[model samples]
Target: MSRERRLTAGAVAVLLVALLGVAVVPGVLADPSADGPVRPGRVSIAESPAIAPEEVDGATATLRLHTRIGHAGNPTDNVSVRFRAYDAESGLLTAERTVELEELTGDRSVPVNATIEVPREGGYVIETVVFRDGRVVDRDRTRVSGLAALGTEVHFTESEAVPPLSVSVASVDEEANRTTLTVAASLTNGGESASDRLRVEVVLRQAESNIVAARQSTTVSGIGPGRTADATVEVTVPSDYNYYVDAAVYRDGVLVDTARSVANLDPTETISANMTTREVEFEVSDFAGDDGSQEERATEAAARTETATATPGFGPAVAVAALAGAALLARRRTRQ
Candidate 1:
C-alpha cells in the first residue's frame, strides 16, 4: 500500500474509535448496575398541603408526595416521611414526627399527616422530608402563624378610679415653630387577663378645622393586668394652629381606649413656608417657655414712695433715686 493511503486509513480508524467512545463509554461508566442496583426514580413534593390550627397546643399540617418511578424500576418500599416543626423566630426545632409508607409504584401520590406543637404564640414553620431507604429523596416546607384567644374583656375608661383598661394623654408639647408635637400618654390594664399584643397610637389634629396633622404609633407585648405602660409619640403638624392630641390604645387589632388633650400653638410661631433643605436650623430653646405661663417675678416692691411724695420732707432727688433703683432691680429680675 502507498504511504498516504495507509495514513488516511489509520486516521479514519481513529475517528471511528473516538465516536464510539463518546457514545458508548459514558453510558457504560454511568450505569449504576455496573457497581450495584440502580437507584429508583426520584420523588418530589407534589402539592401544597393545608394546615389547620388546633385549639391549644399546636397545629396540624398535611403533606402529599409524588413518586415517579421508571418503567423497569423496582417498587419503592418502606419509604420514611419525617415532619419537623421549627420556631420561625429562633429557627429551633420544636416538634418532630416520622411515619413509614407502604410500597410505592409508578406515578403515585402519597398523603401524610403530622401535628406540630408550638411553644408560644408566634410564627412557626413545618418541614416535610421523604426518605427512600436511608437517602433523602425530596423535601418541602411551609409556614404558619399561631395566635391565642382573647379570653378577657377589654374596654376604655376615662376615670382614673375605674379599672380593666384605661388610656389618657398626660401632656402635649408643641415646638415654637409649630412643626412638631410631642404627645405622652399612660396605659393601664386593670383587667384580669394580660394582653400579648398591645398598640398605642397618638394623633394630632387641628381642633377648629378637624384636619389631621400627624399620627404616630408604638407597640408593646405582655401588658399584664393591673400593670401600666407608657408611650410617647411625636407628630408633625402645620405651624400656627390650635391642635388636639388624641391618644388611643388597641389590643388584638381593636381600639379600646382614647383620650384627648389640646395643644394651643401661637399664631406667630407657625411656619409660613416649606423648607426644602434638611439643614434648616431653628432655636430649640425658644419654645421652652412657650407653654403660655406668666413670667415669674423675683421680688415685690411697695409703692410707699407715691404716698410719701405728698409729705413736705420728701425731696425730689431722693424720690427720683428711689424710682431709678426700683427700675434697675426690675430689669435685673427680668434677666434672671
Candidate 2:
C-alpha cells in the first residue's frame, strides 16, 4: 500500500478507539451487575409542608417528592420512580405508584417529581425505588414516627381525682432498649376502695438540644389506699436519649395520686455501696386483739416515761444497772 493510504488507516483506528472509550466504557461503568461505579443515578427526596399528627387538628399527612437522577446515559427514558407503604409486619397494604420524567435531553441527568399521601395513622415504612429498563437499580427506606391516632386520650377509670403524675428516671439501658425508673405515688382512701391501675409516663428529653424527644407510659396493677406505692418501670427508649419519668395512679376513670422520677442513660457497670441485699420487715398488726392499738400507745408511753426518768435521777439507775452488770460479769469470770 502507498504511504498516504497507510497514514489514513492509522487515523481511522485512533478515532474508533476514542469513540469506544467514551461510549462503551460509560455503559460498563453504569451497569449495576458489573461492580461498576454504584451510580444508581443519584437520588434526592424532599417532603413539602405537612403538619405532624401530634400538633394538628385534622388527621391528614401529605408529602411531596422532588427527585433528581444524575449520570444516567442517553436513551434513559422510561426510567420511573415508584413509592410503596408497608405495615409493621411487612405486608403490602397499598399498591405502588410510579412517576415518569418529562424527557431526558441529550444530557446525562433527569429530574422526576411526585407527591404521595399517607392514609392511616400507625407505624409505617416508606420506600422509594428507582427503576430502569423494567428493573430496580437502587432503593431507599426511612421510618416515620409518632404516627398513631392523635387526640385519642387514653383514660383511666380510677384516675379522676388524681392529677397528672410526675416520674423520676433512674437509668437507661441503650443496648437492651430499656429504661429503668423509680416511681412513687400517694394513694388516699382509708383502705376501702383501692387503685387498680398505676401507670407512669416517662418523657425523654434531649440534653444539648433541650427538646422532648419521646414519651412512653407503663402500668402496674393493684395498689391499696392510704399508702404509698414504690415500684420500678422498665420501658423502651430511643437512642440519643435524655429523659425523665412521671407517675399517676387511677381507679374507675378517676386519678387519685401522682409522683415523678429522674433518669440517666449511662451504660456502665456499677458496684453498689450495699455489699449484701437486705430483706425489709414490717410490724404485724393484730386485728383480732382489741389491745393492738392500745398496746402500741402503751409502748410509746413507756418509752417516753423512761426517757424522762433517765434525765436526772435516771443517771443513778443507769449506774446501779451498770454496777450490777459488772458484778455479774466478774462473778462469771471468776467461775471460768
Q: Give candidate 1 misplaced runs (Cα > 4 Å).
A: 1-42, 57-73, 146-336
lDDT of 1 at 335: 100
Among all windows of 10 consecutive residues in model 2, the one with the lowest summed lDDT is 280-289
Which candidate gets the maximum TM-score versus the true structure? 1
lDDT for each of the candidates?
A: 0.59, 0.50
> Candidate 2, residues 1-336: lDDT per residue as tens digits?
999999999999999998889796775445575663433343333332222343322344444555556544333455677876566555665435688765444445455555556544555666777777677767777556444323223322235555333345567654434455544443333454454554545454433343454455566655554544444444444433334444554333334344443444434322222222223231222111232343576788789998887767556889999999999999999999
What TM-score do all the candidates reach, one by one? 0.35, 0.31
Question: How displaced is residue 118 in candidate 1, in Å?
Answer: 1.0
Clashes found in each candidate (C-alpha, N, C closer than 3 A): 0, 35
Candidate 2 Cα errors over 4 Å, as ranges: 1-60, 106-111, 149-336
